[model samples]
Target: MNKTVWIVLALVAVLVIGAFSGYNSLVNMDEAINGKWSQVENQLQRRADLIPNLNATVSGYAQHEQAAIKAVADARAKLAGSQGVAAKAEANNELGGALSRLLVIAENYPNLKADQNFRQLADELAGTENRIAVARKDYNDAVQIYNSKIRTFPSNIYAGMLGFGAKEYFKAAEGAQQVPQVKF
Candidate 1:
């Protein structure tokens, strides 16, 4: 081959290799982000599933606390209706808020707090919340990695061309500000 033709071919090969490397990294990062999001969803689902049993345990003790019961119901309904990740996170936050409210109500009933069933469910719910928090933090961290990659130099170019998008953070509601205080 002529010298000029050889140089041009080598340049083309270099560009193709760089682009493929960048694209593959972005794709892997995107998949990792999605997998982290799925983990968060499963943890949240665990919390949601536990709520009903929690409500029933508390209900048997605090029958007259209609407002607390209603809060839990409303939160669950909101969670059920949520569509996207952002919406689901918002709804989950609301549910956490409602759960916190119910726990506060439970505080007024010493008998309920002392009940073995209530205590057991409370422990389970607390563990579930911890798991959810860990999952959410991991998800947000994954999103950050993907977003950074999609915004930086060559990776950014590949990300944009391949339609890689930024993701939202998973945040807790205002009421999820603190852990529920459980007294035995």
Candidate 2:
């Protein structure tokens, strides 16, 4: 009777330890996912911040292309006010499309492309876009890890009990696959 009681206590201890470990792991992964997402948001904000300067510089040279300029401003505002990963991703994609059109329009104005200020701002925006891409990849990777953890066997049981749910992936916005028309 004593040996059986000891065995049962040991089993319970192992189960408790396993549950605690799983819970802690999930917490850590979730935190990592949040951190990665913040990096993505930071890069996106940087891009948004650069837009006004670019808009101003281009406006000075391409005064007639107000439509393209307005599109960028609208997209930037939408991105800034957007909430949640999916919404933000959609907004960011729209911003990306708008910016692409703006750049394409810039090609028509030789003076805008030749201006040093425009070049610098465009380079900065390009770098920020690259950073945003990297950050999004990191965020998605973290989400994958976190989702896998919560969906696995023993951890899945603990995760469900602890209320840990899978996170949504950052996906390209609708119409992103279509090439944007740049009509002059």
Candidate 3:
């Protein structure tokens, strides 16, 4: 074979290898984003699952706190039915607010606070909330990495060609950064 033919073949081989590598990288990043999102969803579901038990225990002691209980239920339903990451995050924020109200109601009832089951459930919910926070952070981190990859130069070219779009970060809903007003 001519030297020119050999050089051309080598160039083509290098390009093929580089293209394959880029495509694989995009695939891995996309999968990481997807997996992180699942973790966030699982943690949210765990928090939602604990709501019923928490509400049931609190209801027996604070019958007058019906509004808070209803709010939590409504928020949980909304979170469960939410479609995308943005919608789910908004719904989850609403649920967090409702849960805060429910906890406040419990504070008014000494008996409920002292109850063993209520304490355990509250502890579990708090732990679940922590998990949700960690999961959300991890998910946002993964999204950041994936989004950066899709937006950056060389990867951006491959990402666009491969249809690897940017992933959304889990952001706080509007007014979430403000200090919540607590009234007596």
Judged by TM-score, which candidate is best? Answer: 2
> Tens digit of lDDT per residue, candidate 1, span 63-130?
99878888898898888788878899889978887898999999999999999988988998899889
Tens digits of per-residue lDDT, candidate 2, 39-128, equal 999999999999999999999998999999999999999999999999999899899999999999999998889899999999999899
Best by lDDT: 2
In angstroms, give how far residue 146 of model 3 lies from its true place: 1.1
- Please provide, for model 3 over 1-184, each residue's C-alpha lDDT reduced to its tens digit, 9 standing for 90 to 100: 9999999999999988988998898888888888988999999999899999999999999888889999999999999999998899899999999999899889999999999999999999999989988998998998888888778888888788788887778998789788989899
- Compared with the true structure, model 1 gives a TM-score of 0.90
Weakest lDDT window of 10 consecutive positions for candidate 2: 171-180
Which 10 residues in a row give candidate 3 its minimum summed lDDT? 153-162
Worst 10 residues of 1 by lDDT: 171-180
Model 3, position 116, has a per-residue lDDT of 99
Q: Which of 1 and 2 is ahead in TM-score?
A: 2
How well does each candidate superpose onto the true structure, as a TM-score?
A: 0.90, 0.94, 0.93
What clash pairs does model 3 have? none
